[model samples]
Target: MSAPVLVFGWGNPSRGDDALGPLFVEAVEAMKLPGIECLTDFQLQVEHALDLRRRSRILFVDASGTARPPFEFQPIAAARDDSFTTHSVSPQSVLQVFEDLEGRPAPPSWLLAIRGDSWELGTAPAPSANANLRAAIAAFTAWLPDL
Candidate 1:
């Protein structure tokens, strides 16, 4: 059998917008695609990096404060190093670690980042962000058929 397609969502749920990543994973889970594994976490870890090494393809969903207004959905080919200074390890760093341990041939990966506002506790995503999230989901769903 081929390696599975993994959809991983990472973020802190209590931190408003940071919850977008895990939320997206839940949405994807509802679709119940064969060969697709859904994993959600508060943040990316070394273990998660190892898990990614075994996949054929990986889709990472997260919220980004750097993104422009109205939420933006773009395919990220590489994770950024700056993520190390942030609350959690960046996806790129995780992939790099996996490569160092596993000797390359890592799965193809993509990052879907949603622009977010109001990351404080007890807060929710702004209305514009909510709409953007829905659009992002629709776009992601359309891409699945090709996979």
Candidate 2:
């Protein structure tokens, strides 16, 4: 059966700290947890809204320079903006799209932002960022049970 929990992690793997989101998805996948699905992408796009169908909960994981690592998680309400009229969209915009097309509210959703200090292309992740990433994986893994 398809998993009810959907985690979509997006970042450019070629960039240094930008790889954190996809890396988290990989760590979670290695656990082989039941009833959870992990997906990775380079960025959030308009078409991603279609992925929300039948999901129980959704998480958009991304690397953020502003996040005070190991990570930050928060609920995001569906909202639309004139800027979202473009091909790409924010997680909130995606939720809004899901609701607009599905004729109902999107599933409960949250955002997970992993802090990264460097985003230079072709460079490796800094040690500090890697430590933060590991901590986030451990912390969130435990917290998932309560979701």
Candidate 3:
């Protein structure tokens, strides 16, 4: 059976802080927790909507230059947006696609936006970004048990 919770993270690992998404997924994978399926990609695509199937909850992680420091977690809902026309879509857009394809609402979802400042290609993740990542992981772990 598919895991009831899906953690989908996406970012370009080659980019500095942009690696936060995949790095977050890596950390979660190491935890080896039950009932959680982890997925990482360079970016979110329309096809990712299929991953929502059979999931009771979903978490979309990404490095955000605009998010508050450490991270921010907030509930999301299906919404039709301009992102649908782009190759890289947002979490809400993916939820909208899932709803469109299934003719039903998607599983409850949230965005775990990790704050990131740098995005230079080929450089390693910034030390500050890594620190924020650690904090995000801690917060996520604590909140997960209540779910």
Compared with the true structure, model 2 gives a TM-score of 0.93
lDDT of 2: 0.88
lDDT of each: 0.77, 0.88, 0.94
What local lDDT does model 3 show for residue 44?
88
lDDT (Cα) of model 3: 0.94
Model 2, stretches more than 4 Å misplaced? 86-88
Q: Estimate each model's TM-score.
A: 0.86, 0.93, 0.98
Better of 1 and 2 by TM-score: 2
Worst 10 residues of 2 by lDDT: 81-90
Ranking by TM-score: 3, 2, 1
Lowest summed lDDT window (length 10), candidate 3: 83-92
| Model 2: per-residue Cα lDDT over 93-112, one tens digit each | 98998899999989999998
Winning model by lDDT: 3
Clashes of each: 0, 0, 0
lDDT preference between candidates 1 and 2, better one: 2
Candidate 1 residue 138 Cα shift, in angstroms, is: 0.4
